[model samples]
Target: MTRSATTPRPDAAPETAKTVSTGLIIVVLAFCGTLVSLQQTLVLPLLPDFPNILNTSSENASWLVTITLLTGAVGTPIVSRLADMFGKRLMLVVCLVSVIIGSALGSISDSLMLVIVARGLTGIGTSLVPVGISIMRDHLPSDRVGSGVALMSATLGIGGAVGMPLAGVIYQNFDWQALFLVSGGFAVVMLVLVMLVVPESTVKTKGRFDYTGAVLLSIALTCFLLAVSKAGTWGFMDRKTVSLLVIAALVLCAWVPLQLRQGQPLVDIRTSLRRTVLLTNTASVLIGLAMFANFLTSAQQVQMPAETGYGFGLSVIETGLVMLPSGILMVAMSPVAAWLIRVHGPRIVLIGGAVVMALGFVLRAFLHGSVLEVMVASGITSLGTALAFAAMPTLIMRSVPITETASANGLNTLVRALGTSSASAMVAAIFAAMSMDGMPAVPRWEAYQLVFWIGAAASLIGALIAAFIARPQTIAEALRVPGEVVATERHEVKRPEAENEVVVGGVVTDERDRPIKQAVVTVLQTDGRHVDWGRTDNAGRYTLALPSAGRYLVVVSADGWGPMSGLEDLGDADLDQIRMNRRLLLTGHITDHGDPLPQVMLSLIRHSGEYVATTHADTEGGYEIGLPPPGRYVLTVVDHPTGRTRSRAVQIGSTSATLDLDIVTGIPRPRRQPTEDVPVR
Candidate 1:
């Protein structure tokens, strides 16, 4: 799995001994890192020009930026996992290539669709920051790792801060194509540096690809993000929006069970759920939202007219000039943040950074009229962002296993992107709601002030979450242990041994009394304790160990077969034989039947219980329900086209054995009327 880059061994000497200089490597990688965030903000000023250039509506042109953000949000975690599985250097180079190609395509494109596609391609490059940061740790000396990480981390915000004014300059002096050409030049430079100085790390793991988890997660994320991003454009309560939301929910429901069952998951759901990782990610999201307020307010304020009673009325170049100081402040503050982490510790630094960011927002809320006020506010906010961004990686690295450092960091980055995307959508919605007569008429001052107030509230919440995170301390200091700090609090719970034993027998069948495999048998006490459990062998036989002797309820469950339950006295015989009856056989055909209904999925549920199952009827409309346990069940059939559904309750075992269903026809009648004797045989 090794790539061409230098693979540093864990016990090997620091990268300083290598022929290449450590400082040179940092600069090279940092420049490459700059391309990602740069792409995001560089397009902001050009958004106004999209409609005329592409002959598309303003809303359609807006997707150029929104699509890039959405793609980056989805791509970061996926690419991070790939980086770990393959090689960091390889992934980094691949990302740079994408940026180069995307920028080239965008530079020459005349159609709005092609430019949007190019922006998405460039976003794939935007996902490389976390991967680059993780690789830096592997190659840099321990002494340099802290500062190196700080610089790399700050690049996320720094690029955006710097890109704004740069974009304005390019947009004013040249065509919009110049922005793409400039980014393409940056990418070309990074490609050269990546090949020469950046060394690869040896941290690797062995596992098969978790393709199932990846696909399901992607679908869930795409659906969910589309719904959220479109909420502002389409009414939130719109039916299409609600339908996408529902689909997203269902896909997520399926994803959880699938991930838990897989041995090697894409994102470590278990570890990510722990208090340390969980709190850090939560704080990251809030901080991301707070940090994004800077971009929203600054970009709009600079371009707005001073006559609007709130804008500084700065030209594009002037706005870039206004933002220049904040970028400088951010870079300057990175090393200081690194030093603070070494002394006062990361937890305190993170909390302090959050509080400071909150204050910056409040300052913006009160004083955001003149260029001076905006500049001061930008500096304050960027400084806080630099501090918080620097501390997060240290916390995550300390919390997660060494093997998952890059992947965990990637997920942390994704959370931040999620928060930013959410903020973008919220800002769009607020502006849209406040506007009148198709123009932004809301007092420019109030609009900026409201955004700052929102940011302040978000930062305050981040501060509170950071306060609850356990501060990093030596194991001996925290638990009185001798050598190291052990993660005792976040340890997984061990399963308890059985306290008692029991055996049960069941006759499994597939409607014709044929035996079934993998049937699950269990005994549940009244107190919610599982007294005994076992899986049925090929012969439909099972045994279980009881937790204690008591009156318990026995249940048998199998996939495709209905569940069976009964009372059992474990203190007595502890042995029981259960028979499962073939409930209802709701067989139906799926076809146009004069009108075409394609890809129809049928769902069935037991009237008295939560037993449910789904199946897709073939084009011929032919479908059958396997052996259902004896009970009253509700059967529902649905077609995607009309969303038309038909439902009815039919008693199994007692009613006629054969029941036919039709989608277009009226509900089928029960074979035996209420006055007739329902067959119980």
Candidate 2:
């Protein structure tokens, strides 16, 4: 088979080469991410000056920022899907080039329309963040994945926070065009670095690009966000705003079923709806709104005049300086965020982040009397933002297939933009409507405080939502080349409508309450002879048919797990009546000629010496198995190629048991004798 330039050849790199290359790859990708984010904050300090410079009304000049938001929201999923289809590094290069061209255009443009178009082009690069993440996952070693992802995610906050102060200083000293020129220069440097260092993704989803879905989604997002962003200027009830809302709603209603029918959809609505992915994305939206609330309000708060009684009366440069600590905090805390994800699941990290963010806003609401106070509060929230941002992508990656990681991550980023737009509109409306007669045309201090409280509420809601997210069923997905399935999805076995089978059912879970996926629960006669059997779903729920209801033993086995056996009286019952306690625990290891052999398949053999259930040994050749009833059974190693077999006669008890195998010659194949009990074929 021929290989492409982007696909990493398994035999090409030594372990040392991969170790050295992975570090440079992470740095280059993160730098590119940082540069892309600089654009998000680069326009903030220039917004007020743009109207006069470009000879446009303030409303039209606002498009300089609005256009970017609109385009970024629409570009994320499209660029992500493209990356998966073609290659991640290839698409990232395209994104960086777009940013360079956009920045260069804005630097030279004198027309307001030209500048807005330039900003829109720059927004297309926002897809870089998610695609970069997909690239890292595809390339990084398993142990390094958490840190690399954390650093990449933190670039958003770092760029936004650091860019503000840097933008302020540049604006104070140089021409307005210098801002775009500097950004353009940064993009160029990053483009070069990415081309030199980042490897192309080997995980490709080969399919026709969903052009129709792309267009439909872009229209829906653009209309929906435009309506939200303009709701403050145009009355909420204005015909334009209402019309956009109607069009967006109608488009989405039709888009859902269309995507469901397509063979290669731009977005997988089914995967997105998985409990883990759905809740995490929902929390992402709320957290984005909460994070944006800080961006929307804090800088303005410090720049407000002191006479307002709550304003800090700081200059634009000083305002950025004050918020600078939080940006640094974001980058600094990345390792900590990564560590938390490695030790605890992303769900726990997400909950902690949401609560921390809520507390930061609560502090801002009551304690905005001093810049020091505000800065400290901002730092707290930034820490939370760092944690949440890092954890969100990990959750998305764990839940999505390798083929769709980029696309799924892209959809998540788009949802986050929705939150940011909502925050802009919500904060704008609050401050505008609550204002009384005032100098500097600002609202009452209470209005600013109220926005913080609303932000706090959003964070709390995010925390609540995150608490309910379930962990992924199987082992977290690992990055693999295209066509390698990392994890198997648990789907229920459909039963016939009018079946007369006596059904027994229960849920199997590990010690941590996570479902033990791919477990086989066997229903055997009272003497460890199989009668009927079924496998557990990804959720670890299983149902088996009982040939007759007198007495039976159930055994459970999963890959890397030891066998579990228990006794239960079906007692002539239906599905609801069978509630076997699936709590047996057994552990063991497989070795060949005294050397541990991982990935060996083991079968749970019956007392009849028949293979009934199967499992695989893990990386260390260790396995854990849970069983239903404690009984004597023969565990066999079904070595296919060698055809050498080993068996261990083991008895399970109320507690856990261990049975190790050396597989030397064979364990004499367990002295089998013919049984009178009917053998399950």
Candidate 3:
């Protein structure tokens, strides 16, 4: 059966390993995700001492944090795309190795520059969260996917909450190298568990990696993130910050149009444009900004000197302990959030979560009588963040194709990171400007209150946006599975005959060179045996495995476009891009007893009784309907005014044609010959 042009081609059958324990896989993946999150905060307690320890300026020592943010921002999309193209498990393992290497190097080195390099390498592991989530979607049963995603996402909060206290305890007992040692050790264990428990995903999109797109996106993200992160220190209007922001904006302006035209884009911008996805991502940014304010200020509130009138003067360890309950609340709320999502849908959950977060932030803005009060309010926000974060991946996965889960989730993760970066900048700026009057002034109580109020506002705005987000229209859309293997059943050649097939791939485009998505490219052996067939992805690229790299017939077709076929010698070389010039359509006139039947309805159906398209005759009796791939079809015309109807069989070939139908006798009338190219009044 031919694939429908208007719908996504059926996915390949899911490939799962029955021996792998799903529970064990979730444990390993969530643990790894938590480890990655821990890396972000592990050095927070050490940041104050880093300058003296490494004999470097405080500004230079900050690169340890800044570099990772840069690398993680740049790496998330690229690594996620590679995961979709390569095996998810393979990328998972690669990411784990990078973490292990970076951690080990940092554990042994004291040089600021070397540790920054190590941290940059470790940052690559941040992408493993999305890839792991994709693996859960591929392997977990439909009933368990929500919970698995919640657990994975909750790790972001879990590790941040745990990292500071854990770092404090370790720093007081041993040297700072111990922290890296612990992270590297956990990575090694997680890597082994991943290989043993997590099954490799079978779904992969076939295309050449879009290196140019990747490079451009990296430059853009790096510049933008740098500007936002450094704006507090450099001044918002400083030339350096402004130049970076300008460069980032200019690069994005060029990058978007290029991605739209690319045969294989690193990020699927078209899917991102869908209402559900677009709004969820927007809400993600706001929710992220609001949620991070709790993390940023909760411990600081506890550590403030008692003389500040709203201070507790707690030790670093004590402050970390005080704030740890918020992370615990996040974890405890995961199953609750998942249950909410399963019942009311992700959109409702997101909105509810945002509302909850907004209320929590408002409470934080006013309820700081003691550490206990601050902890309770922070925990409430964390609970809401658990719901919001959990719902985002579900919304994204449901809206995007199964093959693109990693990259789509990666983009969402990237946006959330953007929100957090902005939050960091805003918090720093607010604190710096609102300092109390003293030699070494501290931020006044009002600064913290202002941040909380801003968080509340961001949360409410996110909730408002979530209210407008569209939900998936069907249950099947929410639960996409790799259905059937188009590769195995569709191939005409015997499986044993093509043991050593080589992969050939290219893009499909129209006459105007616009990429045509959902087009099918079929490869056949010279003697009429079909080696393999593939469908174009969102970027209009397709791939086929040809037997033994010899000569083969390549056939490309789409529903409304003319079919094209040619023989080409297939090898390791890239196939030439295929272009289809004719957008076949059946245009004709409807008549009744030799008179025109204007404003009549027409339907095009296939010979096998499948619906193709519908159109209506214009005032001049002319009607046009797009034709499907070359086939026998029946065109029916109905005149509503006279209650007359007619049906005629049509044979569409590789070109456009015209016909005229006689409704009175149910017979087709001959088409009129073309008139001369002369002006008519």
Residue 545 displacement (Å), model 3: 18
TM-score of each: 0.68, 0.70, 0.74
RMSD of each: 15.5, 19.0, 12.6
C-alpha lDDT of candidate 3 relative to the true structure: 0.79
Q: In model 2, what is the error at residue 581, expressed in angstroms?
A: 34
Model 1 lDDT tens row, 550-575: 56677766654446666666544524
Candidate 1's TM-score: 0.68
lDDT of 2 by residue, 1-681 (tens): 011222332223365345447778778888777886788889888888888899989889888888999888898999999998888989898888998899899889899888888899999889999999888777665556678888988878778877887888888898888888998899888888888777665556555777888889889998999999999889899999999999999999888887865556788776789898899999999999999998778888888888888887897778878887887888888899887876666788889999999899988888887999989887898889999999899888866655568998999898998999999999888888887585436878889888888888999999999988874343222222222222223421211121112344566666566776556666655543335554454556554433334556656665544455656566343323122233445667788876787887887866866555788889988876655356677787766778777777776554556677788845321112221221111
**What are the lDDT figures for the candidates, one per model?**
0.70, 0.75, 0.79
Strongest candidate by TM-score: 3
Top of the candidates by lDDT = 3
Q: Could you give candidate 3's per-residue lDDT for residues 1-681 as a string of tens digits?
A: 111111111111123324655678778888988988898999988888999989999778888888888998899999999998887999999999999999999999989888999999999998999899988876665456778899989988889988998999999999989999989998999999988887776557656898999999999999999999889878999999999999999999989987876656898777789898999999999998988887888878888898898889998888778877878788888888887876677888899999999889889888888888888888888888999999999888866755678899999999999999999999989999999887234899999999999999999999999989864443222333222111111231112222232445677888687888878777665665445565576667775544355677777777677667887777645577777776667788888788888899999899899998888889989987765678898888887877877788888765567888878877775443332211100
Model 1 misplaced regions, further than 4 Å: 1-16, 436-444, 476-681
Better of 2 and 3 by lDDT: 3
**Residue 652 in candidate 2 has what lDDT?**
52
